[model samples]
Target chain A: MSDNQKKLIEMIVGMQSPEAIELTKVMLEEGADPNTILDICRKAMDSVGQKFEAGEYFVPELILAGDMLERISELVKPLLKEGGGGQKKTHGKVLIGTVAGDLHDIGKNIVTFMLDVNGFEVKDIGIDVPVATFIKEIQDFQPAVVGLSGFLTLAYDAMKETVEAIKTAGLRDNMKIMIGGGQVDQVICDYTGADGFGLNAMHAVKFCKEWFGVKE
Target chain B: MNTATQPTSNNELYAERVQRLNDAIALRQPDRVPIIMNSLFWHTRHAGLSFRDAMYDYDGLSAATRKALDELQPDAYVLPHPIMALGPTMDIMGYRQLKWPGHDGVSNDVPFQYLDKEYMKADEYADYIFDPTGFMLHKYLPRIATAFEPLAKLPNFPSLYYTRIIHSTRSFANPDLVNAFQTLQKAGEEMGRMLGKTVQFIDDMAALGYPLAESATALSPYDLFADYFRGSKGIMLDMFMRKDLLLEAMDKAAKLIPLQAIPAAKHSRSKGVFIPLHWPGDGLMSPDQFKTFYWPPLRKVVMTLIENGLTPIMFWEGGCTSRLEHIMDIPPGKCVYFFERTDIFKAKEVLGKLVCLRGNVPGTVMSAGNPDDIKAYCKKLIEVAGKGGGFIMDGGSGIPDESKDENVQAMFDATREYGGYA
Candidate 1:
């Protein structure tokens, strides 16, 4: 990475949004490749994840890093697409949402950020989404993995119904289905008929990478 | 007021109920484990009233609650009043987070759903630390409450130093501003009257034979911010990026928040202060995060309540299986943990005779499961959690009205059949 690129990584990981934006503008102005910028930011997220595991970082830091990276992505998307790379959906594709009757989006939002930073093309369907929406999104996105999220147990039935609908709709055979959120366990995963479960955002990332055969 | 399972007098039933609960909390085998019916909102529906009716009519609410309690006859009651069921207030306030009874977006049949939103932004931590009351009035309130949107444009509270008279008089020069202030003035009077009624209802319930389970509830510093100020996603990010600020904010809240409830607690005949813990567990955080962000201040709050001659009953909404080892380090018998999901047998092994233990039954099962299932679940729970003493079997969050009426009766039946000291 160039010095400016390295500094950009530092600012993003450190959660300095104003400086990170300025540095991105400066780099693009000097003809720096947008792909390299995204690559460095991804590495910064990986570091943030590591620190989170080691207890040096926490939820706030993860969120701020996600926010800064998102801001930076907004800044460079036009330039990258003009250079024939912005529309690129690389790494992996995953579609996630909170099940019906469940309006909680915190778990879904965190997973969306984790996957996005790791280069996964994530489509968050938001909260209280009906089962039909999941089937429709799977057809449109054709993602490799499907994640069902809900915070309360009332969504247990919704998760099960959605997973069942996906199967009946013939979308289950092609995708690796996953269930997540606060109340899920091995039993709930089976109850929802999901292929696997994620207890936290980090676990969700690992699950996606392993399923798609992507390495760190 | 005379009923079965009593000595044919209201006074005797009251004394026996208090004595039964006190015995269980002390780890002594009571006549049986006392049951606390936490089905507050359910009574409104069971009474054939729209959830909105309970919101506005205190007399109807009190009568409905009393009738339900008489039928079930649980040893204690939790928030069995209209305060929490009041959805009309949310409608008037234009709270974006709540979908309430009789509201345009939601049906009147179902209980209200409170969706979490990020009311406090990332940068407002400094403002909160500096001047909490002023910041909340002008800065935070306007954001969360849509009806209070005009308050954002009002002058800073301290800046309006014209005189004492101006403080009471809200004189908005512009006609639109005048309209806004009038709306607020009327809402304030109505909300105050509603709150007064709920408080009075609590006192009335105490005057009756039923012992109030919890008169006042406050969150730990972490949850107060997580649930109210920042949503779950917001607080987690704050933990990593603004570690110092998060810790400082928790400490400030821990010191200040409990003081607000002291006067109420001192005057009431409640068992003690109650805490409805929301965050800090269920794999949302790491063990290190639990130690650093959650445990200490919570322990301090428990100790503070105890020092004031008030006990702390912490209802772990989502269980704390992993943190039990650390939680065990607190002075035993000084704490009461009403858990929702930790395995009872495992908790018995870990917290043996330390803190009193209560609950693991999810309200979901009772709402749908057959009476036999309720009996079997309680039988197993009593075998494990009720070995020597210190166990109170309760539904996870609450017993819903949709909960099978037989299964609701079967809870106490199972307790009487299987739960015994000797």
Candidate 2:
């Protein structure tokens, strides 16, 4: 890796947004490969994700890092398209939403952004989504994985109903379903009839990666 | 022993329940651990009223609450479920912060939802810090409630003085601003009626031998900004983007919150202030970040309440296991650390000696599991956390609104059966 690329990754990981944005512009001006720069940005995001998993960072850090990545991507996207690279390749398709009776979206939004950056084509159907909406989105998107999110105790009931609806609609076999947010345990997962449960956004990403047979 | 043989008068029972709770708060052993039925809509469910009915019909809400409390007599009650009876008042003012059961297309059975948004824009921090009241009247209120939208057309009221005051009074004559004040008047009347029912409920509960848990409510200054103004996304970015302004705004709130809370607490029946925490849990911010951005202003609010001789019952909503050590820096026996998702055992180990612990029977068990599961959980809670006193038996986030009556009964039964101290 070149010196500027290394500096770029370090700056992004450190949450130095202005410096990272400046260096990205300088690298592009210096005739660096746009794909190479995008690759370094992904590596930085990966490191940020690792720090979060290791408990060294938390939501604020993740949000700051996400904001920085967006700015850098805006800078690099045109160059990549000019080079005929045609945007980053989406590894797999994932459909996610907060289930009925749940209005929380902070956890779901974080998961959506993380999956998007990790090369997954994610469809976020928004909060308080009905079982019919989930079924309709699953048929249209034909996603490899479906994630049900809820932050209330009542959401568990809704989740169980949503998962059962997916089964009744014959969409269960084609996709793996995961449930997340607010006091979810093995008991809840079984109650919801989900294939697995995620404790955080990274866990959700890991579920998608594993299901799609994508190696890190 | 003779007390059990006689029919206890309501006066005697009131004093007994009050003593039990006070002893628990002061880190003293009561006869047994005390149970606080912190359920909001569950009482309505038990009374066969939907949450919509509970929110809209104050008389029905009061009757339902009385019925539930009469059946499951707790040591204390967190009366009138803060927002349950204010549906009409919110509707009058077009309150935009929360979407309730019947008014906003939300299902009648579900709890209210808070809409997190940048009600106060990022660039408006200096304005808020400069004059919070002015900004609140001119900017924040108008933005959040449609009834107050016309208030935005009025000039800054602080600048109006002497000749300016004489001229500024004319702004009030604007038809739109006049309509806004009428709207506020209508909302105030509705609120007065709701509060009348609330006061009546409190009086009835006291007469029937139950005490209200908290006298007044306050918010963490950081939470004030996060929930009502900057929002989760806005405040998270401000930590890095504008630390100084955020700190100043929180400092301002720190000074203002205690002013309202302390006086209200002093005039009320109980000496506790309910502060339901919305942020500053483990996943939202790291320990270091919490120590830096979240704790100082909150500690100020807490300490001020403590200095005023009021107990601050903070209901930590999410898992704040990492921040417990930081929170432990408070005066012993002066506060209650009520938790929702944090491990009760670990909290007891850490804060057992310092402050009273309330809560943490998971809502999942209350809503989904059977009576046996609840009894087992409450038995363990009472056995361990209730070991040397300073523990109050309650649900993780109060009793879940959809909790089964049988499961709730098991909680009360288990506490009485296994929670004896002597």
RMSD of each: 4.4, 2.0
**lDDT, candidates in the order shown:** 0.76, 0.88
* Model 1 clashing residue pairs (backbone): A59-B236, A59-B237, A60-B236, A60-B237, A60-B238, A60-B239, A60-B240, A60-B241, A61-B240, A61-B241
Every model's TM-score: 0.83, 0.96
Q: Which candidate leads the pack in lDDT?
A: 2
DockQ-based CAPRI category assigned to the predicted complex of candidate 1: acceptable
lDDT of 1 by residue, B1-422 (tens): 22236467777877887777777777777877778877756666678777777765767887888877887777788775534545556666676766666776555554556768788888989888887877787788778767777776665666566685476355357555576677767777767777787777766666677778766766788888888888777787777667898888888888876786566677776756778788756466667778888877777777777777776888786657877777776666766788877666788889868877777665656654678978999888888888777887787666754566788788878877787665
Per residue, candidate 2 scores C-alpha lDDT tens digits across A80-137 of: 7554543465788999999998889988989988888778988999999999999999
Query: Per-model i-RMS in Å?
Result: 4.3, 1.4
Per-residue lDDT of candidate 1, residues A85-115 (tens digit): 5435577889999887677887788889888
